[model samples]
Target: MRLLVAFTCLLAGCLAQKPQPCASPALLTGTFTVVTQNEKLEIYCKYEYDALGQRMRLQQQGTYQTKPFIQDFLLLFREGAMYQIFDTNRTCIKSALKDKFHPMEIPKDATLLGQAVLGSSSAPGQGLLVNTWTGDMSDKTGKYLSVVTEFGCIPVSTSYQTNDYGWEVIHFFNNVVGILDPSQLNPPDFCKDTVMKTDEEPLNFLSLFHNLP
Candidate 1:
């Protein structure tokens, strides 16, 4: 009877175990698809992120307002600048980088919602373990939920909503641990003559999309 009780306790403990918080690699490349809650916008992007250098670059192609658009963005947090490049028109807009660099990781205060397997666990070596976490945005105006791989802490998906912006969902995939080309983070040559617009409010990712022509 004692042995049976001990076995049951061990099983229960295993079932209640939680995953530890983990941060993604400092440098990585990935592709993501973004969809807005209103369904008015959908974008597919290939991105390169350098957390250590506080920089990011994105090649974006999307349909907005029933029109197709292509844009490239270079965000340099250290220099406090953001470049929006239109490849088709050879034009660029420079604005201040208002948002701070936020690494891809589970927030320290995030609450773990649950864990699951992405694939069938019945088959050996066929399942990918993942965890979901939720938290309020740092600004307290929004909330976010994210899913990440259990082993490497790679982002799988994230959804966030604010009172002003509604909601946006981003699905990440095909991520690798290192940047293939560091030069990708540099501003395009067309942006060399672009002057920073000091009259307009600084732009974040969502605002950039909403204001797209």
Candidate 2:
């Protein structure tokens, strides 16, 4: 009876442990919606991500501080440049891209909150199993909570709060495994006339809009 009880305890301990961290596919295409606290900024974007090549592209439309704008961004991590195209004005600005590629993955040190089914799980394969995790930002200035599919590690949503940005929630959807067109990562021909602003402050995705007039 003691041996049987010991075996049962061991099995329970194993089941209680959290799963290892997982990463989404290296190459993917997806759409995401971003909404900030106070409804001051909202953005809808279609993106192509190439982690292997260290490049990304985004075509986004958004209202920032109550002003609507359409823009396209090509981030070339290897070249350390970002081309921000103003779609309405047919102008582009080439600025230094100071950020590196950050994969969409649960950090190894993240704390697992729990797991839940996204839909009804009364029948087999009826619902997606997802896990929630919370962790401090890389800079340790903010906190984030994320939900991702259990099996595929696909990101479903994330909420981030920082001293500077306040609260922002991003919902990711329609993500697929690969980039359809390689050229989508390249700067458009109209960007040939891009004004170089490398001498100005370097920009990351979040900081890109602050410089916009």
Candidate 3:
């Protein structure tokens, strides 16, 4: 069955690296949805584990769509994101490794770029892709150094019994040398000043909290 195969991959991904595999036996299964004031989307998933119950891969197919017509998408074992063009059914777009990072907070914003990045909706069949690549690139910088992360779909934590699934990003900046701008780091348009960057004490120099590969 398709569900069985998909779950097997998710299980391998989580358990394959553990010392005593198979100790944790059950798989992680759940549904994920994201609702913006303007749009709604959802994904239903099932996963399988290795002997140690490690997750190996993830398979996600779009279960619902709105405001935008999306063709189906597949999460390859360990690869990239691809979507077909709304205009040309035969045409498909593939993102380079960098574009794969999205839904991320831009920690600093003080800049003047010659471009604009509407939410990922501006493009169809694609996830939330944020762009600050003006190419004009100001003479600015900040910490976290504009990290780039690519995670297919993983639930880091949960609340209210809702299995929060899908990719996540703490911060991301593209093509910046070393500085993070203030305006560029403004809260996401959706958050509207509610979400604040972590200005905590005793920073974890060991990257215990960072999402790095």
Q: TM-score per candidate, in order?
A: 0.85, 0.85, 0.21
Candidate 1, 22-129: lDDT as tens digits: 899899999999888877788999999999999999899898866898888899988889988787788898998888788989988999998999998999899988
What TM-score does prediction 3 earn?
Answer: 0.21
lDDT at 209, model 1: 65
Q: Write the per-residue lDDT of candidate 2 for residues 1-213, one digit (tens) a residue.
A: 999999999999987877777898899899999887777778899999998998989888899778997778899988889987776776788999888878889999999898999888999978988999999988887899999998889889999885545888999999998998888898878897777685678888677544444
Q: Which ten residues in a row have the lowest lDDT in candidate 3?
A: 204-213
Mind giving the per-residue lDDT tens digits that candidate 3 earns over 17-71? Answer: 4211011112223333322222233333222222121211222333233333233
Give candidate 2's error at residue 98 in angstroms.
Answer: 1.0
The TM-score obtained by model 2 is: 0.85
Cα lDDT, all candidates: 0.87, 0.85, 0.26
- The clash count of every prediction, one per candidate, is 0, 0, 35
For model 1, which pairs clash? Answer: none
Provide the clash count, candidate 2.
0
User: Is 2 or 3 the stronger prediction by TM-score?
Assistant: 2
Candidate 3 lDDT score at position 171: 22
Off by over 4 Å in 1: 1-17, 88-91
Best-first order by lDDT: 1, 2, 3
